[model samples]
Target: MRADRLVSLVLLLRRHGRLTAPALARELEVSTRTVLRDIEALSAAGVPVYAERGRHGGFALLPGFRTELTGLNHDEALALLVAGSRRGAQAFGLGSALASAMLKVVDALPESHRDTAAGAVQRLLIDPETDLLSRRQVAEEVPDAIVAEVRRAVFAGHRLRIRYAAVGQSPKWRTVDPVGLVTVRDQGYLLAMRSGADRTYRLSRILAAEELSEPAQRPERVDLDRAWQERSTRFRTGGDQVTVLVRLDPARREELVGTALAVRAEETDADGRLRLEADFQDSRHAVWALWQLATSAEALAPQWLRTALRDRAAAIAASYTSQPES
Candidate 1:
């Protein structure tokens, strides 16, 4: 570990030319005292690294000192830097580790490729919160303390107790043998077994968590992909979902499908709109999703859903027009 830090320290000074002990500490994620010790170690090893004394002073290597770490080509380095810019690592509490690793990647690159790769990445934007239509994406909030407890249990192979708030239910404490953690579209889930039955809990709904020292009873090896697939299939097939046929504006077809469980059929109509048969969790789910399109979406079949929507619309209209009580 010390060897790796020593190497990273050299790389940092090599790339930045001069950095104060405090600055080096920040980059290396260590204390100023540790940075000073590293400098002494480097100098003792015959590497001419010295410190300047004045306010503008810092530690610097002897002029012409450089390390040739050209393992990744220009394109490869660029790819890595770009991938490192993504935000998913935060979900695992590895955000600081990721930042440190990226710094090393940047510093280790050959000088000629380093500057270009770093500069080119500035032009790319990814996964902006507010999309094109100005609707902001809402990210689920999972407190760091809860996430940390759950993560420790999963990685340590221990039993986990969580205060989970299932939809429409009060938060309750339950113990489970955690299998793994999965994140999709910024939402996190804990795939675990409760009383030997498969259960999945949303991380956002985990109000609190405690990692038990007792070892988890899960199999020594797990294929999380397969586990997640089986759980998802069961959930989808078991739900009391309703299938609704709708005539939707062609422009709003994507928006409608985005919230649907499945698109059963599709065809274009004479009016240049889309006739879509889609499945939603239930009548309420169907109505809520379709209502988002306003006049652009019309329920073609399922008279009950259409009636529900009509009554809902009338109520909303009445609310707006009815006079306020004096």
Candidate 2:
């Protein structure tokens, strides 16, 4: 662990340039004294470690100091390559450079570890047919580069001048106080305030964006996390609100709670049946929850929800009707 910490300290400093003792300690999950010792050890190994003490002071490697990548094992090398292949790597716009970097790391690994690394890479797979409309695409496929810039501005709390193409309207230039970026399933939206109205702009429809020299004031009562969670929950349920009452056995109740659908326990019956009341964003989640329940629970109230659930059940039955016995 200590050796790993030393290597991590070197890498973190190399990536972030510098970090204070307290900050390094917090990040490394170690005491300040331990970080200081690690710094000393790096210097003893001929690494040029520079230390500065003050409100703005921290530790950094001297400009010319670079570490040899001779320590990464097979597992570490494989993990790096796999990370470079994930959706986040492309989303972050790292491009093929990450793949090249991973190759370099793999080459640096010992001969014995290289075969294991190759086998691991071959076994690992990414499901491309799975939701191709990714956040990375949202960032990369805006009508113009300005939309991407506006997303960055919103994240950085900067003001923006944009030519926005509002829903069912022609594009118009506007100066907006960028609020936040919203990603719901396949769609990426920018939340901003214009004049007196709050608006959400579809990233794909944005015509252009320009970051302003001056920063905009952010809302005093903004809850970005809550907003995102609510939006995601709504999107998952297909946007029709319904309250469902279900009676479940204890085992089934536990299983239901483990699902993506948010459920609340209302009461427990005398016969040990659990009564659950849940606010569903739409009929889809309600139907999904019902299917999971099968014959274990009764879905009461909201006639449309019941109808939707029955229709889904019928579809499942229809799928099986034409199947021949093997």
lDDT of 1 by residue, 76-175 (tens): 4433543543545555444455566577778877798898998987987777778888988776777777887898899899999999999999899999
Off by over 4 Å in 1: 1-85, 270-272, 316-326
Put down candidate 2 lDDT per residue, 151-194, tens digits, no spaces: 56776677888887776788898888877765543456777777
Worst 10 residues of 2 by lDDT: 88-97
Candidate 2: deviation at residue 34, Å?
14
The estimated TM-scores of all candidates read: 0.68, 0.51
Model 2 alpha-carbon drift over 4 Å, by segment: 1-46, 50-85, 90-101, 104-116, 123-147, 150-158, 161-175, 179-214, 219-240, 248-261, 266-273, 282-297, 307-326
Q: Report every candidate's CA lDDT.
A: 0.85, 0.71
Error of 2 at 309 (Å): 5.1
